[model samples]
Target: MKTLSIDIETYSPIDLTRSGVYKYTESPDFQLLLFGYAVDEAEVHVVDLASGRKIPEDVLSALTNPLITKWAFNANFERICLSRYLREHYPDYFTSYGEDVATAKYLDPLGWKCTMVLSASLGLPLSLKAVGQALQLEEQKMEEGTRLIRKFSVPGLQGRVLPKDSPEDWELFKSYNRRDVEVEMEIRKALEPFFVSPNLWDEYRRDQDINDRGILVDRNFVESAMAMGKRAQEEITGRLQQLTGLANPRSPVQMKKWLFSKDHITHTLCKKERAHFIAHTSGDIHEALVLYSQAQKSSLAKYGAMADSACSDGRARGMFQFYGAARSGRWAGRRIQLQNLPRNSMEDLDLARKMVKDWDYEKLSFFYDEVTDVLSQLIRTAFIPRKGYKFIVSDFSAIEARVLSYMAGERWRMEVFAKDGDIYAASASAMFHVPVVKHGIHGDLRQKGKIAELALGYGGGEGALKAMGALDMGLTEEELKPLVTSWRATNPHIVDFWWKIDRAVKEAIENHRIMRVGTLTIFMQKGILFIELPSGRRLSYVGAAMKMGEKGYKTITYMGVGATKKWERIESYGPKFVENIVQAVSRDILCHGMKNLQDRYICGHVHDELIIECPEDTPVYEITETMAQMPDWMPGLVMRADGYETEYYRKE
Candidate 1:
């Protein structure tokens, strides 16, 4: 057989939502209940492994045959699950991945193809049923998938009666499995024309290997941090109760009533509403608000997730989701949500880490206001290097800003990056026509430049400044509009770039032809608007069209995931499109850096930073030099990297 399309129903007592599939499958109770397959687009077959039915010898051999390609939706699930199934039922057919057969991990991902990855490349839905509906495919996944899996795929409980699976339901379950393979096959065929390049597939393989290798987490720190968080919650909740005399100070209804009693101001007790009420209230009410804010912060829960999600080997796998940002093709954090991790700010982070690892709750309380807050800051320390290894954490400096300058032909901004000068200082110098330096002469002006650079980069104005926490950064209510104006006036080329992109996109979508704006190639094809980046990968806008928007101005409309996270028709203008192009190109640059170093090291990469774990003797400068090497695709685009060596991951 040239190809095998497969899907399997699995059972595991472990909570798959909290712990990832890797930890879930490692459970002793884990097992495969059903296996469905189609060979070379032939008739689909259901192998009821739970009922003792076996896969044929030829197909069993095909699982190990590198010549035959294997296809699946979310291929990682099937590959990892099937590896365990093979080791248990067909050891002879299972290929050894490590030095010893008994110690082997899982099947190699060399010959595997994921239809989900292909769908993401086309900017399609990640779900099988959703993709089928979106593509209007002939064979669709069965709608009863969840019901059947919940009934047959979970373990039986003692004395907990469940409805017996009648003969009809059993047959239906088998058909559900069979239909899944057919739907996956159909999706594979439908998306073949938009296939991701082999280079991208190679990157996917590296992503998988990094996930499979997992990251070593300090279990002692994780567990202690969770315990300290629980204590802090109890103490804060108790303090609030004692101060307010409310039954539960955290309850919105009770807190609202209590606040009204103190200040005669009644409002909704949600986070924003409460903050507004506090800003207007005084004395005990304000104290209560501070207490409530302290109690409601959620940073400690991440440590709990890390403690629970860690595998038996004390490593956390499946923490990064490849192509998680389908639009920009960037990875998103899975378990513990590392992408949104809290920044560390304690005076002596190492001492705090030691105290947490030592489980010295008294010391933790003495040095920290909220023990839970300390625990939250200590999340980075939870990811420790393996024995005899140190982490070389390196990342590009102002990568997005640099790419924006290169694409917009902002010469002065490019020179700032090239000269290794602080962009914020350069921006302040430009906006005020005076010499500026970070924390030096004209240092106070740096705040304006910083806020402007952040808020006005993508055609944002006064509103974006406020949204980006300008007021919190010591800017006044009257300063926002001026900040936006001054920044835009100084960076005229970047502002002009936005409108040019808008014009080119409108022209392309109207005429259904290719148009060039700056370094970007824009075209409309088969109801999709494709923006080709410098890396040769395109960003797709599904169902492209032009419509009069807001005061008779024209705008581009396309189907995309909106703020509500539902796939719907959305609107975009020039600056938003530029944002996408810049981010996508930035992702490609990170990919190039990772590709260059994946052979030697690359434990995990978050945002723009790469975490490398190697021997204590490994030079951090060498890793920094490797990351600084510019890719050939964007020649003249200068790149710089900064890093430091640490026994654990933390910003230096």
Candidate 2:
């Protein structure tokens, strides 16, 4: 097959970060400035479209000719942007590409390839420069690329201002564009040794399709919600000011100093500090902190973002990034973060949403405890179904717990999942060795079980319990160690699995050997630590080696982007690896479910849930049943999905 490797410089007046590529390209002012391409292994070419050069007839024809493949890093941007450019410049070729089934406005995605997706699947960095450096490709991306992008690709001002330099700068920008194509071609070549599976590529297409078929946003609800939030915040700020006499109680430093001045209380107000306050504070101080919390919640940018993210079609798309969490293969949420949505617990959700939508601030203030919190809970409700359809929100029950138990050969836990049992209550019973039930015998002990299950799954101790909020749950300091001991004793097999796998991983790294624990194959090869999961996908740790840290213990180290999202050396241990395995497998299971229902209209998904668009009376149980079927590699792992239909997505 012929390949047209591409890299382009474009200008969009719209904020592409907030409104994704599809919406970004829809802008009237959007322009493809430079088009750089290479045919197969041929020399690269640059077409300065901004300076009024036309794309070659053959290159434009290749786009609509399905046999001529198109490749780019983050190909969604290139593909969608090209679709727009083609529609404007070469309608004949654009029309011939055929309409997309989901969003008929776009060209076909059949031959599009994303090198970023390829890098992510292999656990390489997502950035073009980073991937090139990691793979040590001889043809590196130009360092001047960033500066050139700011000069040329930035919105509004690029066409107006000629920089301090001249035609030479434009030439440099063109060279940068050409170099990007060269780097991208080299990357594709480097990755060809372990090219991503066709199935994974298909999954990438599905992701792009979903992003194109964005979920509907209730504009009325969103607009009213934003207004109500502002009003509520103003009221709260006024109250807080009257009570505290602080000039800016919303400022953390000001609030801390004010609290100290009030009662000589000086302490760190970080997570641990705030957790202590929630557990131990009282009187006026507690009221002040709670008010501050509400004000903080009110100021969440998501409410405003919902309005911005909604396209002209009244739908918000591109909230998901496929292969975003490189380790777990999970789709990370972007802009309005569905994966991290606040769980709605309002008893009368419809009433609360209606009040906010109606902009009845007084009704919300009187009926609800905190109007800002109400706005926070109502965020998910903003994502509504399209005009004629309803959303069927369904999710796997205790998927990670079930996967962990099944992987560890825990029969009792499997039985619980097989019967659709409440794992929290069952876990509490197992830990307490009592009839710990949900609102039944020793019901109070369920919290202990819940916290333990959350914290202690991967060889955690009392510190983990504290981190998981045992203290906030009102457990005594003395009871923490005992609780950890009891939970470990109860789930002896799980604990054993953690340490057994730990030993095997360390040995595999240290001796440069293969270690098989359960169906997982752990080995070190060519400076990369590979864990071949039962699903046949491998978790990669590039430039991996064991290093003894300042903590005086040797641990596994690898090259990765840290919390700050910069390339650096990352450290890990046995429990963390176990976490990666469980999450990756859980993510794979969700992917499998999504793929199984390919014909179904899956509009959006939270971590473990899939929100499908269907008719009001559609049989949702079949969706759940289909999702529960385990793949061939995942035998004896029982899974269950629960679902409910709604006009919009919710916690149900």
Candidate 3:
């Protein structure tokens, strides 16, 4: 199939960084300056539309071609910008794919390839310049790009902003846009060998399709939530001013100085963690000061105002991102960040939601300390029941724990799961050697169990415990280490399982052979490898390889290693590989459950939880039982899934 790789220079009145693509392009002040393209990597072409050059007939035809692949770094930018361009230039074609087309039928997200995602897959930096250099492309585009964006971008004056229209500037804009496509093409070529595998490309395609079928949102919930957020925001502002004896106290830098220099909270009030904690706890004075400062940078006071610009129609659309967390293949959120929002604080969510909708700020503020907490919980409330249906939320119970044990062949751990799978409490009891009663009976034990399970799993030690806020949980430093040790010793089979999988993966990568642990197969190819699950999905390693480290033993590392490009490094098979295995197995379990729930229920999922919108009469217990069963091949590894049917998506 023929592909047209294109790039464009555009101007928008909205601040691109904070406002993002939606608001940036949505502005009435948005306009295209130059369009650049290459057809089959032939002679690269530039059309200086600003300088009055007509788009070539072929280029115009390619834009309309259903089969012609359009490529860009953030293809969303190109797709959206070009979409706007097409609708303005050729309305019939644009509207055909827009309001008229049945989204599931003609929406081929495959028509575009986001080189940003491709770069991410190869562990290349996000910027086109960085990606080009990483691929060792002959030409560099960085410095040229910086100057060109400034040269062609609409100039800003005090009261007016206008695009550059000089013929010379137009030529430069064309050149810059051309280089973007050039750099992108070069990166694609360099990574061609890696993408040669059909599975990888197929996965990439499916990811795009998933992005295309972005989730439908509840717009009314969004509006009501925003209204409540605004009212509380104003009250918080007034209270902060009263307490701090300063106007507009939300400034971080100013708040830091005030807290430390005046209030004498801490010397290091400038630090984020310290400042945030102190700011929240300092009551009216500290919060007021912080609120003033925050308003200066960008008003949290204008809480819900941003939502309308961020949201899509009555439904907040395009929330799910395919492979957004590429490392874990976890979906990321675009607008609301549904993945990381705070759990609902109110026990009776429906009542709290009603209060929020009615703009009852005084009641909510009375119960909740900061408006952010209330706002955070209310984000989930945005996901509501469609007219006649209620959301039946089901999730794999102790899924990560179950997957780890099953993959590791830890018979002892599996047996525990088989017999009532409350691994957190079970882990706590096992660690303390005391019988753990159910939640209400064993109150204090629950906290210990929850912390230990959350932190110590996947071979986490002291540092993990600290990350899980063990100290903040009123556990002393001495108790933390011993608790970790006790948990590790109690789950000895799980510890051994980690080592077992590590050895299997290291052997597979080093020997260029396959290693089997139970039903899982670890395969290596040219230092790039993945585990082939019994269900047949191969977990691709980010940077799969083996090398002799400081430990003097050959260690293996997987691909997509780090959270960011800076701190992420290939590390030892001992811990890093354990993390990989645990996550991979967890992903497989989700895939397994997803396959089962595909057509029988609404195929909606969030992290480990699946929200199946069902009728009131539906038997929830049977739903849990069905998810508990495993695939035929994963024998003797007893698993279970349990969750409540909530009117709104929330944790029970």
Score each candidate by Cα lDDT: 0.83, 0.83, 0.63
Local lDDT at 338 for model 3: 55
Please, what are the lDDT tens digits per residue for candidate 3 over residues 1-652?
3988888888776666544454566667677767888889776777776556777777666665767887778776776676666667665555324341213222345567778776665445556776666556986674766666655554555443233445565555667777777887887777676633233445554444333433345555566666666665676667666766556556555565666755456444433555456446665545554554333422222224335435233333345555555454556665555566556667767777776777677787787666555566666666665567677788877777777777766666787877875677777777777778766556578688889888877778888988888877878888888888888887777788677778888787767778887666777754457666665655556457776778797666554435566424456555455665566556656656655664434425677777676777787876777676677657666776777876766777
Whichever of 1 and 3 has more TM-score, that candidate is 1
The better-scoring model by lDDT among 1 and 3 is: 1
| TM-score, prediction 1 | 0.95
For residue 166, give model 3's deviation from the true position in Å.
Answer: 3.0
Q: Weakest 10 consecutive residues, lDDT, candidate 3? A: 98-107
Residue lDDT tens for model 1, 421-536: 99998999999999998879999999889888888888888889888888877899898877778888898899999999998899999998799986688998777788888888
The segments of candidate 1 whose C-alpha lies over 4 angstroms from its true place after superposition are 96-103, 156-165, 264-283, 548-553
Which lDDT tens digits does candidate 2 get at residues 1-652? 3999998989877777777777788888889988999998699999988878888899998886767789999888888888888888787888422243447667677778888988888888889999999888999999998787777666435364343345888888888899999999998887776634457877787888788778889999989888888888888899899889998889988988997787747566664676567567787788888888777673357878788788788888778888999888889888878888788888889999888788788888998887787788888898887778898888998899999998888788888888888788888888777887789889999988888889989878899988887887889899988888888888878887887778887888889989999999988877778888887878888778889887998877888888888888898878888899999999888888888998888889888999999987798898899888878889878888888888877886
**Residue-level error in angstroms, candidate 2, position 368:** 2.6
Query: Candidate 3 versus the native: TM-score?
Result: 0.78
Misplaced by over 4 Å in model 3 are: 11-33, 49-70, 91-107, 150-155, 158-164, 195-234, 237-265, 269-312, 362-373, 385-392, 440-446, 500-573, 588-605, 610-649
Candidate 1 overall Cα lDDT vs. reference? 0.83
Candidate 2: pairs in clash: none
RMSD of each: 2.3, 2.4, 5.2
